[model samples]
Target: MNTPVSALMPVGWGILLGLLAQSASAGFIDNSSATLTARNFYLDRDYKGESPYPAAREWAQGFILKASSGFTEGTVGFGLDATGLLGLKLDSSPDRTATQLLSYNPVTREARDEYSELGITFKAKVSKSKLSIGTQFPSLPVITASPARLLPQSFRGAYLISDEWDGVTIHVGRMDRVNLRDSTDYGPIGLASPNGRFRPGATSERFDFYGGEYRPATNLTLRLLRAELDDIYTQDFLGVLHLAPMGEGTFKSDIRVFNSREDGRAKAGSIDNLNVGGMFSYRWGAHSLGVGHMRQFGDSAFPYIAGGEPAVLSDGTMSADFVNPGERTWAVRYDYDFAGVGIPGLTGMMRYLHGDSIDLPALGGRDLKESSKDFELAYVIQSGPAKDLVFRVREAFYRNQQDAGSTFRSDNETRINIDYTLKIW
Candidate 1:
């Protein structure tokens, strides 16, 4: 007979709680929930002769445990949240692999076997305000977890969120380390430190941020955000979100603008970047349409996640990573709900993205262009024994053009996800 970790978790937690009660002012186990999920994906790429890398095919499996509970009653309400994650490499080959679940060693051309992490957050609330210290999963314009792959990325930091004022909410935080979606180790972000090269190090620490959202009206929300990345840059953002009724359904719109500039040591020289984007969606019955455009200005690329040490580049240029000095992107999408067809919990969406005028340094010049088109189809089971089960399929075709070289490639991915939740309180 084998005892599963899930079965023994409550006993272990009970013992730990007893030990903490001996030292802590007050403690309690109020709520517990467990979830299990898995993902299957496939990818393929075809490059021109002597391309920098070969084609890839891979699949991944992941398990995540999130447990949270409220602390003993006191002057200030206290709580603790803990998360555990496990990732396994189910399938991969030298020619086809991804860094979503495991980091690939370029030299060895092999993926790591398994990766895991444990994160905890301690929080206190007082008079409509809350403060937390510990690792957190953040989703903001400046600092957001990248869930583009199988597992989502995480950050180690302290944060505070407050809603003391009517119609307004405020957020602020400081982060020092980032655990990417693919790796278990926590590393520093490029903007967080200035180590000459773009590599994760321990010497860098980013300054905290201040931001807020105001919703004076029921249908509109306005946001303002500002942050300073020590020795890297400073960024400010403004956004507006609106929701209104249209026909038999509703209309939604989102507009965002960002102004980024270099500060302090200014490692990446002087930063002068501005991004503007707007998305609009209209729904009539079971069908919806969405369109958006995003543009990047200045001589630098819009920085997001660094993708870790063995970074995955969008271009095929070795020794030269592609972030593009200036880029313009446009997107269009459509969605349909089966509920309108008398079937509930069934929805589908298809989207396409195109980009042009990319800035590349190694193409003998700075005039290069790249574009990609992706199609996706997904369905979720609404009821019955397999309720909440999901199936998805996606395909992407990418093309790059420039005076020096041109190449084309395509990739396909599929995933089957199933999740169930149990509440024990």
Candidate 2:
């Protein structure tokens, strides 16, 4: 396999992997799981303004292989996990390149036909705690992997998670390098664009974070997290979730808040931001209704992993995230469960979000606004020969307050996805 990125294994990784080879070859084989998934993804976008040679569209096929070994029998258990990813471009051209489905050639301005990536993690378990060293796919409030594309992003480093006490979980880790969602190369962490686009500059090699979650009650969860991207920025997060039974329905509330500031040396410049958001929902039978609100404060935009999808406050889907400097957003959504109507494998969702008070210092201190309407329909095979086969279609219409000549204009995006997984244990 010709992998796009070469891994520089750390010292601890070498030692742990050697131990895994010995144990996993014998005791660990008793309990192990292996799976492979095939994903076919296609995307198309219609620009409202002048297009980059017209609308951008692309299609790609992906294969993901995952293998995990059970822990060796002992007080100090050991195991190994591996992930292999491959993406092949099915339809793409120079005029329809750079849709983030595949890597693009700079000179030719064309997407590559194929790309691959591999990652491994060696784990040690003791009691309720586990430590992993090597590449990882993390999903946390402060940092997360972008799995919305053909290939998900990965981080190269170590992670430690423990749940020694009842109803409480602790997490600590550091990621020095990141493999972006599209490209097959590892690079430093950076800041994300307000519009969820890619941007260059303001990067850091060390991204250190530690956090914990506490569930004091069966229906309540609280989280606190802190992180620092060395020389770039520091961030703190707080989140709360609650669920209550209301008649035959359920009422849910989720709140998230973040505080960020420039770190020592301020490589990403003077950064300051406070993001707060919440979602309230009521679900009864086949129908669910939700409303959300979010606000951004400070002179700078919300800081997150650049070129990657971090689940910031009120950002759940891939279509759009209402996060801009000094921005305020409100959203309403509806969901239907086809299972309640005898369609056991289908579901649909629709949402609309409106945001205003966008501050663009780069565009001469101008303020703008944006809104997005999104819809999705999904289905999955429940059983039989095609069990677990899944299909989904998502569409979004986004309009921003930017001028027509601006690079960020109104556009419509649509994506179609099909996936199937096979177990090889």
lDDT at position 58, candidate 2: 96
Q: Write model 2 residue lDDT over 267-370, tens digit each, in one string.
A: 76777889989999999999999998999888777888876655654565555566767889998999999999899999999988888888765543456778
* Runs with alpha carbons beyond 4 Å of true place in candidate 2: 1-21, 24-27, 51-53, 194-200, 404-408
TM-score of each: 0.82, 0.93
lDDT of 1 by residue, 1-425 (tens): 12322243354455346436633444545333445555544434444334445555556676667777655455566666777877777777655555355667767768877777888766666778876666678777667666556567877676789999999999988877778787788877554211122223413455557899999999999999887767777888888999999878889898888777777777656667777777788988889998877777885655443542211112212112224457676767788888888877767767666667776555434565565555656677777877766776655555556432322232233333433433333
Extract clashing residue pairs from model 1: 55-95, 56-95, 56-96, 57-96
Local distance difference test, per candidate?
Answer: 0.62, 0.82
Each prediction's total of clashing residue pairs, residues at least 3 apart in sequence or on different chains, is 4, 0
Off by over 4 Å in 1: 1-19, 22-28, 31-34, 40-50, 191-203, 308-323, 364-367, 402-425
